[model samples]
Target: MEVSIIIVSYNCKSFVFECIDSIKKLTELITYEVIVVDNNSSDGIEDDVVIRYPDILFFKNDYNGGFGYANNIGLAHAKGKYVFFLNPDTLLLNNVCQTLYDYLELNNNVAALGCRVYDENLNNQMSYGKFPSVIQYLLEVFPVKWVSDNYKNKISSEGYLTEDLDLDVEFISGADLFVRKSVLDHIGGFDENFFLFFEEVDLCMRIKNAGYQIRITSQAKLIHLMGQTMQVSFQKFKWFEESRYVFLRKYYSKKFIVFSKSIFIFRYLFLWLKYLDKEWHKRAVFIYKLK
Candidate 1:
């Protein structure tokens, strides 16, 4: 096979149908396989996708394994030269596969490629970003978002301010990361440590560490409904806080982890004081439990 399109799905039923329908057209250009790794979603989605596209490889998990684990499951079944890690909520554009595949064909050094990312309204998103640092995170969440966003986040801002509809990007959204199978074997797929957020950054960084180039193909396009489909059964703040700590310990140095924790402390403090809201206090206490 030339390509294996892997989509890790949770409970989003309609989103899966639309995504597969779009990708279905691309089979003519390149020999491809679509593997839908169902993460044991509460919704009866396995029967839904399989009934429509019976030819698709459906690997249904009995448990709600994290994103990385579910993706690894699909990767194991992949029989393609290139593997596409696509979000379930996005729609592929015409020639999206061919565009990314042809680009990787010429540039053997490219470890991964991503399409130009746009939201549901077709607005350009900040598809590329510097790996999250304390300073960057500060600028993003601070009271002075207007100034920090425009001035400090230049590349991030520039990525959104593209003159051309589609252009090369530094870091593409993991929602649609297209990677070569060889590079995947070398890096051993996404750091299964990351359950959700920053998994792509960690993956791209590892590939760069192994001396490979990652690309954001200008021609490929996809409509991303950003965070609409991602969800957890528990309290949003609680679950995110749990995974945040997990991510920090796995990716950051001990000192960085300490620094990050302090920042989180101060952040919640600032929010609590500023809001003077009881909800803020509860969230602060929740984060403390994380430590």
Candidate 2:
């Protein structure tokens, strides 16, 4: 197979069905297989999906593992040279698989690539970015317009939200990431330590450290119904915060982690006091006791 398209789904049956339909309808000119790993969602996605697409390889876990854990299961069974880790909430707008495959075939230096991602209304979404740092986190907390503008410019320059041309980037979004299986094997796949967010960042960091380039291109496109699978809630915020800490701890020095945690605690406390929202207070307490 040229590509093994793996989708890890949880509690988003409709989105998964639509995503698979889009893949089947739009993707052509590439030899590919579809794999769906269900993280024990309560929805009857297994039966429905199996009935609808008997050819798709489907696995259902007994419990909900994190994104990386579930995808690792799919990776273990993949038989392709490249693995496309696609989110269940995405719809292909073009022959995205063929486009990414062609790009990687030509650019041997790039081990991973993501295509242009858009919202349902066709507005571009952030599809790639620089590796996270304490400095970047601090800048996000600042309220000055010029400071924010400068930060945005830095992201643009570093290839965060490019719209027109293909660019080598520090990391690609997990939403539509296309990666060589060899690089994935070298890095041992996504870090299962990341329960939610930042897994792709960690994977990309490892790939870059292994001397391979990461990139994003505009030659292909997809529509992502952002946050459809993982809705914004306190639990989602908790998972994000936990994964952020995990990522920083893995890649940063002790002093850097200490400074990052201190800044996060201070920022959350400030939000708690300024806004007086119980949610902020809860977050502050949660981070304070995260250990």
Candidate 3:
């Protein structure tokens, strides 16, 4: 196969359905295979998607293994030269699969490629940017968001700035990444240590360390329905924080982890007091438990 398209799904049945349908409708020339790893979805997603799309390879996980683990499962079975990791909540505006594939085939140095991403309302989302650092995280959660925004704008994805058609970036959103199987094998897929967030960043770090380039291209486009599968709640926020710490522990220094933890404690406390809300307090305590 030329491409193996892997989508790690949870309980987002309708979103995955729409995503798959868009691929079938738009992709006309790419020789690709779709593998859907159902992460113990309870919404009858298997019945809803697998029955309808029998031609696609579907693996129903026995347990919830988070994003990286599930994608690893799909990767093991992939036979394509390139593997495209896509989110169930994203819809391709065009046959981006073929475009990215051709680019990789042409440029052997480019290990991975991320395309432009927009929301359902056509607002561009930052889908490419620098890897997270201790300094960057500290700035992001500052008291005044304006200060954080200034720093984030430098590292995070700002789709409005389109000066370069082919831009080399530190990392791409896991939502829409096309990567070579050789690079993935060399770096050993994604670090399963990351449960959810920062998994892409960790993978990109390894890819770059191995002397490969990760680039962003404006030649293709897609609509990413951000946060469609997971709802924003104390639990979700906890996982986000948890995975971030895991990422820091793996790549950063011990002193940085200590610094980040201290800041997190103070920030959560400030958030609780600032809002005087029970939810904020719960978030504070949840983070405290990590210590």
Return the top candidate by lDDT. Answer: 2
Residue-level lDDT of model 2, residues 190-287, one tens digit each, is 88999899999899899999999898899989998888787689999899889988987888888887777778788888988998888887887888
Cα displacement (angstroms), candidate 2, residue 41, comes to: 1.1
Q: For model 3, how does the per-residue alpha-carbon lDDT over 121-213 read when each residue is reduced to its tens digit?
A: 987787887766665666656635556555567755233334438888888888998999988888899888888988998898899999999
Could you tell me the TM-score of candidate 2? 0.96
Better of 1 and 2 by lDDT: 2
Pairs that clash in candidate 2: none
Q: How much lDDT does candidate 3 score?
A: 0.85
Error of 3 at 20 (Å): 0.6
TM-score of each: 0.88, 0.96, 0.93
TM-score of 1: 0.88
Q: Over the stretch 1-291, how does candidate 1's per-residue lDDT look in tens digits?
A: 999999998888889888999898654678899999988988898767778998999988999768888999999999999999999998876678878888889988777887777888888865666655676566655647456455675534224534444344445577889999988887798766666666776777777778887767657788888878955434666656666677667667888777766667777778889888777677767766675
Candidate 2 segments whose C-alpha is farther than 4 A from its true place: 148-150, 156-162
- Residue 267 displacement (Å), model 3: 2.0
lDDT of each: 0.77, 0.88, 0.85
User: Which regions of candidate 1 fall more than 4 Å away from where they truly are?
Assistant: 143-151, 155-161, 165-170, 231-234
